[model samples]
Target chain A: MSNNNALAARVRGTVHVIGAGLLGASVGLGLRERGVDVTLEDQSPTTVALAADYGAGRLRTAQDPEPALVVVATPPDVTADVIERALTTYPNAVVTDVASVKLAPYLELLRRGLDLKNYVGSHPMAGRERGGAIMARADLFVARPWVICRDHETPAEALALVEDVALDLGATPLEMTPEEHDRSVGLVSHLPQVVSSLLAARLIPASEQAVGLAGAGLRDTTRIASSDPELWVQILGANRAPVVELLDAFGKDLASFADALRDPEQTGAKRRIADLLSSGNRGVARIPGKHGSSERFTSIMVLIDDTPGQLGRLLTELGELGINMEDLRLEHSPGAQIGFAEIAVLPEVAERAVTDLVERGWRTL
Target chain B: MSNNNALAARVRGTVHVIGAGLLGASVGLGLRERGVDVTLEDQSPTTVALAADYGAGRLRTAQDPEPALVVVATPPDVTADVIERALTTYPNAVVTDVASVKLAPYLELLRRGLDLKNYVGSHPMAGRERGGAIMARADLFVARPWVICRDHETPAEALALVEDVALDLGATPLEMTPEEHDRSVGLVSHLPQVVSSLLAARLIPASEQAVGLAGAGLRDTTRIASSDPELWVQILGANRAPVVELLDAFGKDLASFADALRDPEQTGAKRRIADLLSSGNRGVARIPGKHGSSERFTSIMVLIDDTPGQLGRLLTELGELGINMEDLRLEHSPGAQIGFAEIAVLPEVAERAVTDLVERGWRTL
Candidate 1:
């Protein structure tokens, strides 16, 4: 452990985590790994016990002392209520919640006339498609953005405590107001979820032959539609306004595109279509690559048979060639004995890599 | 070359390909590998010369006899005109165009009062994000769907020639009418492209922080939106009717979903949202998995430090354990020194695999 990660020494006493779900258990597990005294709880005794059994934390008891900090990691629907209760129950404890949406819970607490001085609403922009204690890992939060929402009335110590915890869990601390966090997630997370789900839903009515014509494009666009719907409902409802606005804007773009295509004979109609498509290129360009940079890499596809050692051998050969693969994707066609390993490398090396591979009796595309 | 692949013997004479783009060059290379005499042409002399130098095919000579088969592999916008020219130039030849959208080009030929008895429309459902001769590979169409459009007036010999070419290139030929082919691709390919593009375009105006919050979901959904916009514009415009209808229907779904979430407390509103999401689940399940089977696999995430030999070691260990990975996806957190390798294995071996991995000092999440 790094010296900077001695967060356990900073906290005066125990850290109690309410709700032993994925985020809560992950927080507990990460903090406990850093030698923090962590206690876990949940509405269901089984969940808390299961989280404890997984080395997330020990279960709280009547004999235990009051916690110095309380983390409420519950489902979004009950986040406000839980945070309200946590602040009241742990009078001196700094309380924070890891709900995906920020504005709703903060506004809810304000509406309830709760003094929010001790509470710092935060969201750790980290999760797996599947959730629960069983899926929790100590490194889940590592390097992910942990957005802390603090008002002017919020105590410096409380914000520092939350930031320290975020850092201790190996997360990058980002400060954003509740509204900013909600809108940001509304664009990035919630909007994409709805679009993906709706795109996949269209396939429900399509013919089997039509669906069978599905390629990598359709598969990619609908991949996230497989996420849990119950969790999404709560999230979407929490961040309704921003997501709705985004949907409206996106719907207009779709409609306008359809109009442009509907009458290509109109002057500039074709250009409009090209413009919309190009806009997509520009928009996707903004997304950071794996290294958090927008710089692109050239992909070289190498064909391999569907055998155990083929990919390993190819990668081993690539290593021998002194080619640093920036990214790797394996694509297998339906009912094919062949697979394609699409390796992304710096553009400058792509030509040489392809030539070398082809010369070495490997087929590349 | 396999003796059974007597493509040279079957062709009787040269096969001419009119576009030195990815698909056309790939077809040329695959056929060339099978010992078929192939002639290449393109709008750009340099493109054709480069494709020839790459061994895709040789340049046609003035004294060369008429091609036995002429494949019109032009851009989507000019596919029909090129197909007509190919048919007129080689009257006895079996003419085929490998354009993406079938019905549009087919209809255009009919409207021009040209006899298309020798012409067959086909689409090899294969491409890379980046196109051109440089990106071409011989195995591009291997096991990929190559749709052939045939009508009652179509001769058996002409259809057989096209099917043979598809087979010779290791593609699976599926016969469908022009209308059916257009509609199928409209749903499976065109609709998803539009949706993905629109979703991605929404990100163009988003804050940098919002884009930073993008995860695998956004990445997956927008993956194909990075495709060549110029090529897509021609495709979307050609298949305008069916795609418009799809977008309209999808728009209604999005509108209803937004409305449901907007007033989720209303009777059956929440149920409506849940039903839509569940439909997406069922729809995605209908997509054939790798190797044409819908067999699901259990994925286990293993955490590893981002270092050389870590992934190779994991795969090597997996081989030692006699575990066949169905699929593998690597995810790295931004600025983190650790990564997660999500390995998909058959459900039966998942439990044992996890246990054995943990015992071997590997962290399985």
Candidate 2:
């Protein structure tokens, strides 16, 4: 490997990645791009070979030296075992695992009476709906949060090594305790997953006519319910406590909301409904904007044809018009020939942007 | 008004709109554009004048001939009252309404023992998130579903007149009983709205760190929770029974899902969770596509900078390459300088489209 990246010099030896799935392979691909030597392994030889062919990393060989860092990127169910194995095999190396749930595996390692001073539990908050080596991307972690769970007993060098890998892969490293990581994800990820699934599940028994009335709102609300259930089963099981608490609290809220609407003639029923909905508005507003703060941008919708280069041209014209696009979203119906390009820009430029586009024979909505 | 549309000719005289809000103004604009005689009215003089200035229609005058049709486009709370008044004021003209809830008004009028032969309950399932005349578009109802509810005593001419206006406004007319319309909307629209609002409301008490970890799933699921709570309260109250029933059933489903996750070690617990989630997939799949069927498409993600014209150029190139896009969605992270344009294409052509895009220096994921 070419020794080009100063960041990779922190690790003196090869970095071995186990599992070779989407997350593992992506880590390998990213590290390799930085001119770091990476070795790949998986339970399935075919999977490892596929990752290798995809340039994620070369397969681990006997001739390879003991890696300075070992990354375990297996499924949640097997994460603890693999982390234990990696630590036992590479006593000289600092070990880390990129598992979504943090507390379970960490507890499991502790329960096994293993010395885990060198093992750091980390998770890159990045993934697509699907998984596997073939779907791995070197830039998957770019600008995304990568959480590192460390103990008080862990050495500073060990923590620095894991964080270096994260930075080298273009991920923003965040230090959190295992408990904190579990609780946060339980609220942000697992709770939403279960709620969305339950919401969509109600549709299963709906009449076709009812489903026919489904619009963009329903589509957006239930979009994530289509995620792989088997994978979710393992995730939810591993992170059961926080998710269960979230679900219980959410269920209480759902019950109260329904009760208020059911007998709206009751005193304060309407007020309750309005207060809850308004709280939703405030809650959603608190989510960090695409650039991470609470800043708001105005969006202008431009109509475009589905034919190629049309959107490109519109975007190009906006460029020529000196409009800086803060964000851009293309929306098309399932079978409509026309699509909408919703471009976000500074609020001050919104009126002028629409006028300029309209003057240029572009339809702005 | 000049005679141009044969559908407008079905009503030989002027069409009077009883409100100047978004739907009322849109109906007026659409009818006026098609050379139909349109007269507008509103409790708010300023609102009526604004709609008129936008070319929706002129204000009604004492000297004007009796309208051929009266459209009650008032708020849901006032719909029944306005419909009753319109029926009494113009005994010869057929009366129809464009309120979202149908049965509530129909029953209210029936309970008053008013003659119902000329009354038609209609709803145009088209609206922007925001309301008022400024958001009204002449083509707002184009390709959207417009439902008409008729009673046993409703004259054929009354039904035809309502259907004609729906057709003239470029909507597909769907005939249903008031009960059916209420039930259908309860399942598809009302249920989802309440569920989403409640889900988002849970976030109000969540820690900032949890909200910071939110992804597209959380965003998508709660996007509509920002809707006007005042309007939703009226709609839900007017259609209380169906919505209440739907919400109750949905609440039960959420509880069961949580229970299953809480005890996955029990017999069939994991399987039950999987089944419910998988059912969500089947349910979402059952939703009619934009063109009115359930068809699936493949999506390709292309990376673009937040710069000008880059997206337009890529789209133009896709058109040049003869790749027909089925749907397009743009995704970006807050604080990230880059965005992703996800384009949908036919499954058969997806591979070639990706290849062609990559060859043209576009990154496809």
Candidate 3:
């Protein structure tokens, strides 16, 4: 590995990581780990020091010279401005950014007359609910999709450099236009956040007893609502137009659903409920499977006794059959005699596992 | 514990669990575990057998006599009918029900001319995504709230028996009216499910490239969308009125938000985003603190390098501080220098932990 490092000797020029927040610091740390000479700069002295202490990069003082690559990992509001600054500050370097929403920044860069030849716009679709340089992770990008938005004006060399960085971090690089990226994320990312926040907002006035009764469903839906308000303010604000359009469409569907529920006729109500429920079914079908594409799995229902070792025993039996379980659900009735355990497994092995359990005096349903 | 078992024997009697599914079976198993004589009956013979095989209770044939307490653990659609049947078939037993939605079944019981004196409507707010008797757990009700809805006509003996059953299962018992319970759940439970399903539905048509970019946030928000459609149809249908009302309110708020975002004025757009984001702030505040009531906790931002042992080391340090982390977040930024680790802890310990980390070689922000 050291010989491989020697073969890929550091380019004489330094790599400048702008903003020095979570994304910026992560990029610096990841590149430094790969034997790149990285210099970090941030608007906040405290953030710069924090990133430096974590070995993200050496702190770049104001007098530091130009670099080969400049990664701008600032907020959406300032990504374009920082990118433009990097382009001017290091005329020989390639400039890139890690921002959630891409179109606006890309447009702003073009309007500002920065050399689009040296710039590439990208978004690494990975993040936690937290923020700042303190949470930088070298492997945060691994196995995640890193979207690169390339326009007709984007230079091939610059795009390749960005893709190389993405691959180095163990991410899959996907190419999309800025417009497509925005609209796509509007449905998959921003819209969900807005919807989650809206639902969570409803609980603000809920009674203590009501809130206490909250179960996993509510927890899962509102998990993103616990995100940093200030950061979301910027993200949603920047992507407001696309998100609003999606929410508007969603509101129409919700209205239709509400009206159907309010109808006195049972047929229409049941039909509407089924339709809405079926929509969810189709949506679940579209989500990528464990390894990145959708594939159907067989579901098996087993009767499990309410005992400590019962579940362990069931899992052990299935494991012995070498049946890889995809998903498992344990349903509990409040005062029922028994519960049903629904397990999802490979279709080929599901029947064998079921037959095995049944043969062992275990009830299979 | 053996002495406790002797004390429990003093109160043992024939416990009739009406529904033989997961909750009902679990109740039977719990009671049976405590040496209580449990007689389980279900509308369907298959379910009854499954519950019996899972040890919910000994299947009670038609010739069996009525038990002391009857637990109606059927689905909401048939809960009232089952309650009525149990009352008519075993007139001597004190009857209670375990339904997710309470008001409709309770009202239906009233309409069917059942003896309200012998019946107490109860809901144990616990369940898995799947259903059936095979998944029952003897401790499913442990430490969770078992709500008993009572009216002026309800017999004190019936309420006492229900409370006894709940206590025997180590559940906390709370009292409420059917109306209050329904509305409370509308805000905290049903509405969130609809919202999650609706959001998940939006992802059906998302581009494969975009879907590939999905992170943990999308996963969390849509986790509940995978719930059984047939069961949700019954749940949403039974509680249609309250759920529709809440959805209508949410739609209105969402519409207002959409209009705000579409406004051409920058200031107005930003103000709207701020409103939506701030709503989340208040919403998160209303959620109960981890394992307790609603209380604010301090969130510490820790800088984490994307390395194998980095997270483990941070957790170890926190454990050494005797600080129990309430929540955690990992923010992933593509092509960034570092990831952010947001750790939620008790407010009193936040400052000390931050200082301790800073004093050690770690950065705290």
Candidate 3 chain B: worst 10 consecutive residues by lDDT? B330-339
lDDT of 1 by residue, B1-365 (tens): 66435667778899999999888899899889888889999999999999999899999999889998999888998998899889888999999989989998988899999888998899888856347898788888998888999988889988998899899889889999989999989988999888888888888888887788887778888888888998898898889999888888888888888888777788999899888888888778777666777677899989877555566667767877888777777776556677788888889999999998898899988
In model 3, where do residues sit more than 4 Å from their true spots? A2-12, A59-65, A264-267, A295-365, B1-12, B264-269, B295-365
Per-model TM-score, in order, reads 0.97, 0.97, 0.84
Can you tell me the CAPRI class of model 3? acceptable
The digit string of per-residue lDDT tens for model 2 on A1-365 reads: 34346767888889999999889999999998988899999999999999999999998889898999999999899999999998898898999999899999999999999999989999988846357998898888877788999999989999999999897787888899999999988887888788778778878877776676677788888888889988888899999999888888888887787889888889999998888878887767777778888677897878776666777688778888988887666554434466577788989999999999999998776
DockQ of each: 0.68, 0.68, 0.29
Residue by residue across B1-365, what tens digits does model 2's lDDT show? 34356756778999999999999999999999988889999999999999999999999999998899999998899999999999999999999999988999999999999999989999888745357987788877766778899978788888988998897787778888999999988887888788778778877787777777777888888878878888888898899999888878877887787888888888999888889888888877877765678887888989887777777788778888988776667676656777688888889999999999899898778
List clash counts for every candidate, in order.
0, 21, 52
Candidate 3 global lDDT: 0.76
| lDDT score of residue A261 within candidate 2 | 82
Query: Candidate 1: where is the Cα deviation over 4 Å?
Result: A1-5, A320-322, A355-360, B1-5
- Candidate 1 vs 3: which has more DockQ: 1
